[model samples]
Target: MTSTSDLWTIRPAQARDTDILADIYLRVRRTTFLWVDPGKFHSEDFVGQTPGERVFVCEDRNGTIAGFMTLWEPDDFIHMLYILPEFQGRGAGKALLAALPEWPNRRYRLKCLVKNTRAIAFYRSLGFAIIGDGSSPEGDYKDMQLSGN
Candidate 1:
């Protein structure tokens, strides 16, 4: 497996990927939630949450999981979009989002902790617009939506 930025592949996650996905989830969360208590970062709940969502993983040409995105398709909401810190800014996140099934005239939404400026900028770069604000266990969050064309 030899993947350049453009050569990475996206595919539906498999049962075998649960552990890696959970690890990625936790790692990314911990990095993004630095403002929160470190103890609050380790949770097994993410593994349970994976079964109910539509998860897609991006794999490097070497077959390594570089990132993943989980969406609650029926609700038109993206639950998470996490790329390994090393993989960030390399186009993996955009590739994952672009692979989502297109829905004509239907918008997709997600929330990012207001403190996660990097994520906010990344989402904004991808056309997601800030629509509102709210609070979460981690802290203040901003609701963002991407309009369906």
Candidate 2:
């Protein structure tokens, strides 16, 4: 997708944002993860994400942290996509999800808690298909895919 006006400026995360991101992750851990997350993660546990993962945060015009989403490369896994409850429906989730797939891979996949019907519907609305199921040692979440392939 071509860059929009950057109404929400998107930038590469820095060390400073790490604390903020981790905190947000903690605050909304359940809203996003949905699976059997062990508990609130330590800030340091969020350091690198994964080798090919790309994480981004969105700040409203006022500069408050709104939310964040992550995409893992090659597979373009929808690692996380969440907007603060206060920021929900304002397009933060859509924006962050849209911003992923800079290279536009053929197959994209993500997992959502089996109980989060809302999330499942949202993903379906965006054209993802439930392909399989996955267990994270945490629990089983429905695996979804949208493959340009």
Candidate 3:
């Protein structure tokens, strides 16, 4: 991705950002992890209790929640990275992608639903290469492992 300030600021999520963070939880949750084993993702309780794992809202000039990304360092996997549908392709996600390294791994890993072709391509463009494929806990979902700098 390229560098551009565009329309947002990056910051740690605070307790006050609780509502917005919850929104992220609701918007994300099973939808993205439907292809990962249940054990790899955080438990529902962490949504409100784990502040360190979260990044707050990236608002546009008008102040809307463009989206946010959260990290779970133990496994080198980005727990969640989401941009509201309206905010997609406007640098929000890319900016968040660029920010991932701040969490510490130069080579990070994340799994994506194999059926989400759009996400697969987006991750590929960001230099994520495939490392593996498997089924989720349900044994019904197709998943792909992605790794990149």
Question: lDDT of each structure?
Answer: 0.84, 0.69, 0.62
Model 3 poorest ten-residue lDDT run:
140-149
> Candidate 2's residue-wise lDDT over 1-149, tens digit each?
22233556444566688788877766676555555564645555556563456777787778787878777776668787766788877777666666665433456789987777777888887778899987765456799987553
Winner on TM-score between 2 and 3 is 2
lDDT of candidate 1 over 1-149, digit per residue (tens): 22235668988888899888889988888887889876786657577766679888999889899999998988888898999999998889888887777732457899999999999998887778999999999999999998666
Number of clashes in model 1?
Answer: 1
Q: Can you give the TM-score per candidate against the true fold?
A: 0.90, 0.78, 0.70
Query: What does candidate 1 score on TM?
Result: 0.90
Candidate 2 backbone overlaps, count: 0
Tens-place lDDT digits, model 3, residues 1-24? 122256776656667766676666
Off by over 4 Å in 1: 1-5, 103-106
- Candidate RMSDs in Å, in order, are 3.0, 3.2, 5.4
For model 3, the superposed segments whose C-alpha errors exceed 4 Å read 1-4, 28-56, 102-105, 137-149
Over the full model, what C-alpha lDDT does candidate 3 score relative to the true structure?
A: 0.62
